[model samples]
Target: MRGIVMAAPGDVRVEEREDPKILKPTDAIIRLTATCICGSDLWPYRGVERVNHTPMGHEYVGIVEEIGDEVTTLKVGDFVVGSFVISDNTCEICQSGYQSRCVHGEFVSQTIGTQAEKARIPYADGALVATPAHPDPELIPSLLAASDVLGTGWFAAVAAEAGPASNPHPDFAPRMRPVDYAARPLPSRSFDGAHSAGSLGVAVRRGARGGGGPGASGGSSGGGLR
Candidate 1:
């Protein structure tokens, strides 16, 4: 299989690499259907971060090709979305909903590159979430966003206490995609509400700073403000 490798700062190549295999009981191999370049990828490309033959890409959506003995929650042919971080979601921190900080967590970008035909995922049961069924091709991009950006925005919104009553300013409307997708139940509305709340927080802050009108106060009770 061929995967992306960053040979050095400002240097990237698609090179032949050994196929990935299950390395642990909780591992799973996925044949990537779609992957996208994340903003962080530019760090190495722009020479701000060190790069020495590093595998690139972390955001992905794919079909399960194989699973290890311990991976019980998924089966072959399942369409799944995985987090950027590999985690054993049973840890106390994960139980608290911070799987990215799980006691046994690893960044997928640091080890496995999804920008290839297939890649092995560690802690498969914990890191991957299967869709109810194969999703529409058009929804693939939105599902892929759930892997990272959408998740981050949702978390930020939750931290800010954004909710249904919170009114996000129009200027921040473009940031409401999570909310729109959430309405369809493809992922969940909580992610949407939180993502909207997070964006509302930004709008509120700007309003408080005199950037917008007085209506920003409507979001204050929704925890859009500190």
Candidate 2:
């Protein structure tokens, strides 16, 4: 299958790669029909990290082609959407809807991300959500958003809302003193809510592109996980 590869910072390219094969007991290979770029992917592309030639995508919608013996709730030809964070969605954090911080979670390899013809998903029973059969193509982008960006951002927002930073103190940023872990986390929530919310704005923009009215362009009512 072909995928986007980043050999170094500012060196992203679409290239052919070896087809993925199962390497673990909990893996499921799926043939992706749709996938996308996440802003997080831009980090390494911008050289914030020393990343190279890793898989390039996380969000994916595909049909399962194979499964491991340990895998359940998934079978061949099953249409599915997977989370960017490799979560089993069964652990304590996952049960509380924190799949991104799963006890046994994993990240998709940078070189073999979701932007391909097929992908091998680990923790198949937990990492992916099955959708209705033959889903509408129009819903693809929305569903893809849920797989990673939406879920991760929501997790961040929820975390910030708890403890010293509740909704009541929405603007009450914590003072940054030495060891001020509390406030540090909340500001990151800025990215959390903003990133999640930013996409909704994009959806609204999509609506505007569809010729929706002025208020219809990339705002509260426009873009969000379908």
Off by over 4 Å in 1: 164-226
Candidate that would win on TM-score: 1
**Candidate 1 local lDDT, 1-226, one digit each (tens):** 9999999988899999999989898999999999988877888789987889999888889999999999998899999887777767676655545556567777667689888889999888877777778989999998787776655554454443345666643433445643553333222223322212222222322333454422333121111122
Please provide, for model 2 over 65-139, each residue's C-alpha lDDT reduced to its tens digit, 9 standing for 90 to 100. 999989988788888877665766566655444444567766664534877788888888877666657688898
Task: Assess every candidate by TM-score.
Answer: 0.73, 0.70
Q: For each candidate in the order shown, give its overall lDDT on alpha carbons.
A: 0.67, 0.61
Task: Supply the TM-score for candidate 1.
Answer: 0.73
Candidate that would win on lDDT: 1
In order of listing, the candidates' clash counts read 0, 12
As for candidate 1, its clashing pairs are none
